[model samples]
Target: MQHIGIAKLGKRTKSLVKRLKAGDIAIIDHVDLDRVTAESLIDAGVEVVINASSFISGRYPNIGPLLMASEGIYLIDAVEEDVFNQIKEGDEIVVRGDKIFHKGKVLASGKTLTVPIIKEKMEEAKKNIGAELEKFATNTLYYMQKEKDLLLEGMKVPESSVNFNGRHTLIVVRGHHYKADLKILRSYIKEVRPILIGVDGGADALLQEGYKPDIIVGDMDSVSDEALNSGAELIVHAYKDGSAPGLERLKKMNLPSKLFNALGTSEDIAMILAYEKGADLIVAVGTHANLVEFLDKGRAGMASTFLVRLKIGEKLVDAKGVSKLYQSRAKISHLIILVFAAFTTTITIIMSSTTIRGILRLIILKIRLYWGF
Candidate 1:
């Protein structure tokens, strides 16, 4: 089948997704693409994907390719490494099987990934998990030695302006269907009104849902300037050498922020910060917890995540989907909202039809007669 679309190219998949439009061809150089990137691209409504790197390097069972293929996305893999240079942005391009043709010229070629092919590759990656685990474990041990002081004793977290003391803290990260989880937690949010913390890009996610974050924590690379100035206290994540590059971004924005120097991911430090500040419960949404997720994020080992979870222990809850079981403890305000909703519905029904109004009156009279009123 010959497929055609306008080309939209970027070296970084996440960055490109922001500018992508529906029906455009996405061109990228992501190696062993991660699920989050795939989800973003799918959300952008692109029909075709062209990758200049190995889509699955067999390093781990990454679900990016599988996600794209299952969603009816055409994935062309291992094209020339310089394919980005060949196709200009907004060029009309056509693909037939593995060949790329533009304006009657053969520009480049690669293998078009299908669902079945992705399934087979994932199976092979599974068989190699044992070796990958060994490497991950070794890396963890190595980093733990170098960063133990920071993880255990040297963690200098500042007093957050947002008081999390004895309160429930919700940390939102833009990972793995976070928007779905957040949508499900809306009611819980309204009732409990937990202290909301957005990790980098997750801050933008919170803004999209019409909630202001109490605290924003991360490396400051992906978060927007508007989010930085959203009145949320910012906590900057720093490197092992006590240098925080994210501080520059904050300074340019002319906003005040505090720095927390640590070795692991920003999300890990965020959890630690909440736990240290006496949060009674920590609910994490869109944060990666499994080995596959770590590998997908290019983490050699999840040492900090491991240590932080052990520290938080009984107070932490990971929500697979928050919409089902999470309900806010109902209060008088909830009753008021419910009653208001019922009143609005009653008024609409009464105005819409005369017969419906008569039925309601008859039911009320019957109740009054039965009560001898």
Candidate 2:
């Protein structure tokens, strides 16, 4: 198949997705492409994806390549690095099979990804997944040992204007199935009215779903300016050394924010902030839970997540994928109550109406006459 489109190149897939438009060719150097990036690419409506690095490194069966393949997106894998230097943004590029062309000159070539090829690579990756798991577990234990005390002893949170005391809090992260999770929680959100917290790009997710986040926590790189300025309390996650890269952007934007210098991911800090602020129940949406999820996030270990969950204990509720397992079915008790209420309302209506009472008395008198009672 032959297709032509404008080339949009970036070393970072996440950053590139923002500028990408439909029918644009996305040139990225993403290795072992994660699901989130693939989803972003798919959402951006790119016509083709050219990667300098391997999409499936045979590491642990990353589902990103498979996801892209399934979506029928043309993927060129393991292309030469010179492709980036040779191509400029907005240059009309042509993809004919495996070769990329710019103005009739061959810029680079790579293998075109197909469903069959991706499936084969996934099979190979799965075969060696045990080794990957061992390495992952070892890294997790190693880091957990060192990081446990900091998380367990309690973390120092920055002052926040939002109050979480005795109220349910919802922390949204732009992780796997986050959209579906949020969709399922619509009723709960309306009824419980939890304080909404969006982590980085998760703020955008909230906005897209017609939600206004009460708190926006992250590096502030992924979130849009509109979200940051949506009257939400901003909290910048910083390194242990007290350096915050995201703070500069907010400062430049003239947006006031509190700095929470801590270790671990931004999602971790968001949860910690709610816990420290005495939130009654903390509900998490689109959080990374399993090994593959952590790997997808490029996290080698779940040290911080494990410790944070432990410290938070039962107060934390992971609402990830709850939509798949359970639905809002009416319970037996609820159904019974509903039926009883309906019956009571019918009887009350009949008793309250004079015409209905007269008709009932006439029917009773006729029955008594017929029976000679």
Candidate 3:
């Protein structure tokens, strides 16, 4: 099969997806592409994907390729990295089976990842998951030993202009099911008026959901300029040494921000910040929790996540699968049944009440006399 589209290239799938338009061929260098990136690509409506690296390198059953295949998106995997240097953005490229062509010149060739191929790889990856888990656990232990101070006594929490003391603080991360989970919490957000905190690209997610985040925290790499300029207080997640790469972007944009210098992921820092500020309850949406999720994010282990959660304890409510926990709203069929029951109850009351029956009968008698029936 032959497919043609304009090429848009980026080494990072997250950054590339922002520029992707419907029917545009996405050229990415993602390896063992994670589910979230696949979802982003699909959302961009790209007709075809050309990956410079393996779609699945037997890396613990990553489902990005499987999802793309299932969605019928053409995937050309493991192409040469030089394709980035060879093809310019907006160059019309043709994918003839497993090969990419630019201007009728064969640019690069790769394997076409089909469902069967991805499934087989996934099974193999699952078989090696035990080994992956062993390595992950080892890293976790090693880091925990060194970073035990995080749990023993947290870092100096920065004072925020936005108050979290004794109020619900919603921390959003751009993880799995983040969009659906946010949609489910619309009413809670409207009612409780929680302090909304967005971690990096999560700030964009909040904006897409029509929420103006009260505070934006993260490395500031993945977030959009619009979200940064939304008047939300910004906090740059910095290294323990106080090196904040994200701060430069804020400076260039002339957006003022505070720095939270600590270890761990941005989401972890956000939670710790809220807890340190004496938040009564912290609600987390789309934050990574499981081993697979941590692995997908390329973290050697979830050591920091484990320690952060241990520190936060019960105040942290994970809303990752809350959408599956209960129906967010009553079904239309259920609403119909409720309306029918209410109508039936009113009719039954009118028929069963003697005073109501007498009144109805008198009204009917008066109408008949007036018409001389």
Clashing pairs in 1: none
The sequence of per-residue lDDT tens digits that candidate 2 reaches over residues 95-139 is 999999988999899999999999999999999889989999999
Q: Per-residue lDDT tens digits of candidate 3, residues 1-373?
A: 9999999999978889999999999999988899999999999999999999998888699988889889999998889799898899989989999988888899899999889988998998999899999999999999887777779975897778887879999999999999989999999999999999999999999999999999999999899999999999999998988799999999999999999888789999999989999999999999999988888999997778899999989999999988888775778999999999999999999999999999999999999999999
TM-scores across all candidates? 0.83, 0.87, 0.91
- What's the number of clashes in each of the models? 0, 0, 0
Q: Assess each prediction's global lDDT (C-alpha) against the native.
A: 0.89, 0.92, 0.91
Q: Model 2 Cα displacement at 77 (Å)?
A: 0.2
Could you tell me which residue pairs clash in candidate 2? none
Q: What are the root-mean-square deviations of the candidates from the true structure over C-alphas? A: 7.3, 6.3, 3.5
C-alpha lDDT (0 to 100) for residue 71 of candidate 2: 88
Q: How high is the lDDT of residue 15 in model 3?
A: 89
Clashes of 1: 0
Name the 10 consecutive residues with the lowest summed lDDT in model 3.
145-154
